[model samples]
Target: MKLVTLAIICVLMLNSCKNKSQEEPQNQVKVEKIEYASFGKEIVASDAIAAKSMASHYKTMKTGDSIDSKMVAKVNNVCQAKGCWMRLDLDDGNEVMVKFKDYGFFVPKDITGKEVIINGKAFVKEVSVDEQRHYAEDAGKSAEEIAKIIEPKRTYSFEADGVLVVQ
Candidate 1:
């Protein structure tokens, strides 16, 4: 009788341990894989506004005024020289010039026409003629086209802390 009782207790303990082990994985949180190529800082592709909405927000902003935002847009152009900057289409005729924060990161130069999510500060600024010409040069524009950027232009700009190029 004593041997049977000991055997029964051991089996019960083993069963309980097995049950606990089986329940652990079910209680664990699931982690989702990121599908974007990240740059600068790691950022998830969540809560980003559409390009059209982002354009509207830019329209309401003035020079020197900025707002923290996350937006998704199509890459219209990128700096051909070294991928230092990019232009994103706002679903409108206007494009927003995006530069990485602190010049810390650069997106792939061949990523034009790809969708990207950017997290940063959006602001309106008057870009000087010299700067415009410089950018035109970096874009590999013709000499005449660079010369045409003779006027200071007010434009939408973003300083991105993080960027994710959709793969």
Candidate 2:
């Protein structure tokens, strides 16, 4: 009886391991952040100040402080559904949410961790719960997680007229 149970357990374990391996693609792409894009569409390089400088420029301001400027930054994340928005990484784990001006262009959904210079109006805004939920849905977050956004949150945001992604 003991030998039979051990054999059954080993078979089940082997099956589970096989299933897990099969679930992953053999050609799975490794994502990496870069000064130039490795996974998204190519673009000619242009110049802008570093992302740190943009953050520092507003160190003493409260929400609603707006600055019209161009800045270069790393793409932290993009909207998984439509590429309608992106989050730019800043110093100290901060991020600025960016949306295209007049819905003119959408950043590539796979441009995570690439560098780009954006010409835009940057400001801090209090994102309402409904807006937060909408973004969570756009990002493909689970319904349970979206439901947890009950309070407003303030963060840096941008409306970009043009963006030049580095090659």
Encode model 2's per-residue lDDT on 55-129: one tens digit a residue: 887565579889887888989889998889998987657898999878867878888887888887889889999
lDDT of each residue in 100-151, candidate 1, tens digit only = 9999999999999999999999999999999999999999899989877768
* Candidate 2: segments with Cα more than 4 A from true spot: 1-47
What lDDT score belongs to each candidate, Candidate 1 first?
A: 0.94, 0.82
Model 2 scores what on Cα lDDT? 0.82
C-alpha lDDT of residue 104 in model 1: 97
Error of 1 at 110 (Å): 0.3
* Candidate with the greatest lDDT versus the true structure: 1
The C-alpha RMSD in Å for every predicted model, in order, reads: 7.1, 15.6
